[model samples]
Target: MDIELITNILFAMVRSGTPLLLVALGEVVCEKSGVLNLGQEGMMLMGAVTGFIVALTTGSLALGVLAAMLAGVLMSALFGMIALGLRANQVATGLALTIFGAGLSAFIGADFVGKPLVGFAPIAIPVLSDIPVIGPALFQQDILVYLSLVLLVLVWLFFRVTRAGLIVKAIGENPWSAVTLGLPVLRVRWLAVAFGGALAGMGGAYLSLAYTPLWAEGMTAGRGWIALSLVVFASWRIGRILLGAWLFGLASILHLVFQGMGVDMSSNLLATLPYLATIVVLVILSSKQSRIRLMAPMSLGKPFHPAG
Candidate 1:
């Protein structure tokens, strides 16, 4: 369509994609350390509620964001204890985490329903934001938008250039050998889980504090699961995670745009596009299981013990 229309669409994609990008990136890190956290939804919900409450109470968005990250870390640490420390079933513990987060967020956020909170406003870069079509859509965004990109870069660099990054990679590839090398496999996994939790918390906070500026129960609305699938869909690569999140985000926003255009269709059906796309991608990837096996972390989802 027109340049204006195209710009609006691009801007919508960026806005819609940021939270997914954040969550998926965090998950990549978590999975890299051989921990499959199915509790992304729960962690995100906890973050959203905790972040909103802190922001509303203190009138400081930054403090609220910090609180949200802390909440995620605590939730994830619980997962680490059950899955990593106690040597429980990783998949089962993750599923339980999601259920716990949903009920807990509902109970804690029940009182704050319908209350409006100030959200992050866009910060336009002076000269760059004023440029023709690209600037505003790409450059003028809230702090978290930029932070998400920075996090992606950091994650890539962590795996690429740093010694700790190599150690984490080594642990993910073969925990037994990592242990043989005396790399502190359990401790590394715990740190990775905590880091992933923080990023997931940040993602959830971005939703409440920037995207919606309001608190709602189960507001994440399957984005967490979508983020989970995105990690696999990307084949555990950081760049692909970026592309996949935006693709899903664009699909998500299109349903809204369709409704705005007064297209006659079931809204519920339209809303299913993103989830449908996720399933399709998973099926495609699964059909090529050999490729996935090569890309995936060797010990993913398996609990590790030093002696075993």
Candidate 2:
């Protein structure tokens, strides 16, 4: 059925968007707390490898996830230490982490090239999944897809209601006041970065265990970077991350459509759709609201250390 094809496509978009949503959520948290975290790409790639390796070794999905989270935490700490503790340049450190992550994943993943995880099987919700056309498309999905939605609501509530969330925003706006009020700015950032890294790692694991279920060199293929851009495109907001991920997910699925349609084109150009969309969206937003680009962080890519 043609409807089935389109239905499947929509389902794929949700699955594809899940990883981006997870990564962007973390980046949003870090950005909210006044950390740019360029090392997101690196952290993600390392998580991908670690997740893949542990799953292959232990035959346990939960253990693999834990391993991946630990790897992400370790790598993100490296990023935080360089950029935050040492007060190094955020941009430079992030770039270096990206490079290191790419190389390290490639090297470590060499032995596991052909092996892949079995990954999560999709589950259908009771009544909703039984409905006609849209039912299977929207209602039935993997655990991560539903969890992403739950995260959306949880994050929104956190920023809007919680005092800790308020502290994060306050620190981002004015560090001096947060410090004066006895807020542990550095500690907050540390927790934020660690949580963000763990989420990104989970995102990376989703790509391996759920998205592809395979290990390949550079498998993330800039999805990490795209997720990072999405945090900006969403203006460090939670709800917008859902929208942005879906948009990018659609952009990605377009490539598959082109292939299905048998359009003769270079594989390279065909694969560039999602990245192109990221750039185009950035340009459009910049042109539309140069002044009110609500997606931008006021203190992005800036380092902060309390005065002794």
Candidate 3:
């Protein structure tokens, strides 16, 4: 491909990956705290619809993004009350949250379907953006894209260099031991869940406010689920998560590349690339069961009972 084509493809890859990076980052934190939340898809949908509506009605993208994050937090709080507070089945509760969010967001967003609103504009760095092919792809992006990169670094630092990160890791590994050591296991778990929800919401907001810049039912298109898989694919490491997200993003945009090259293929089948990749990753990971067990948080998906 020519320099311009390469640049465009690279740029698209980053844009496509940003939402996954955001959601997966949050999930890494949540799972690290020993909570397995399957409600990310639902949270993302709610965030997308809520953000779109707020931005469209109020003409303020900031409020829309904030509203989206709040919507996700609310959904997560519901999950926490049942799964964490009542010690309900985490998987079942998470699935229920997804169903609920999907229905509610669709209902609320029905009126605003296809309505137009201006989305986030790309900001190019002065000197950096003028460089070669890599520069345009890396330096020219919307504010959220840059924010995602910053969040990735911060999250890595949070896990590698901070006391709170150690506490969360300890909780995930052995909540009982953490409790015995006088750690606030329940409180820390709640906070982690909330943080995951906020980021999931932000990811959804990016979809509505910047990525597609429009509202549609199920716009997340299983990106949330992909994000969940990405956490595993990255082995819960922040740096690997970035690479994995971009790979998936590249997978997602292959259809566009093919179309541009005048390649004949079914659009529907092409659209399934990302999901297909997800299944393949899961299968490969499943085969290495021992490795996964070694890397995964021991207390993951298990309800914590402090009194017991």
Q: Point to the candidate with the largest lDDT.
A: 3
lDDT of 1 at 86: 97
TM-scores of the models, in the given order? Answer: 0.93, 0.90, 0.93
Better of 2 and 3 by lDDT: 3
In terms of TM-score, which candidate is stronger, 1 or 2?
Answer: 1
Superposition error at 176 for model 1 (Å): 0.4
Ranking by lDDT: 3, 1, 2
Give the per-residue Cα lDDT of candidate 2 at 306.
80
lDDT of 1 by residue, 1-308 (tens): 57887678878898899988998999999999899999999999999999999999999999999999999999999999999999999999999999999899989999998999879999998999877777877789999998899999999988989999889878987899999888999999999999989988988999999999999999999888989988987878898989988887787777777788888988788767767766766666564465456478878898898888
lDDT for model 2: 0.82
Where does candidate 3 have its weakest 10-residue lDDT segment?
285-294
Q: Across residues 1-308, which tens digit of lDDT does each residue of candidate 3 receive?
A: 78898888889999999999999999999999999999999999999999999999899998999999999999999999999999999999999999999999999999999898899999999999988988977899999899999999999999999999999999998999999999999999999999999999999999999999999999998889999988987777889999999988887787779887888997679877766765766666565574455377778899999987
Off by over 4 Å in 2: 262-295
Model 1: residues >4 Å from true position, as ranges? 262-277, 284-289, 292-294
User: What lDDT is reached at residue 158 by model 1?
Assistant: 88
Q: What's the best-to-worst order under TM-score?
A: 1, 3, 2
> Whole-model Cα lDDT per candidate?
0.89, 0.82, 0.91
After TM-score superposition, the amount by which residue 240's alpha carbon in candidate 1 deviates from its true location, in angstroms, is: 1.1
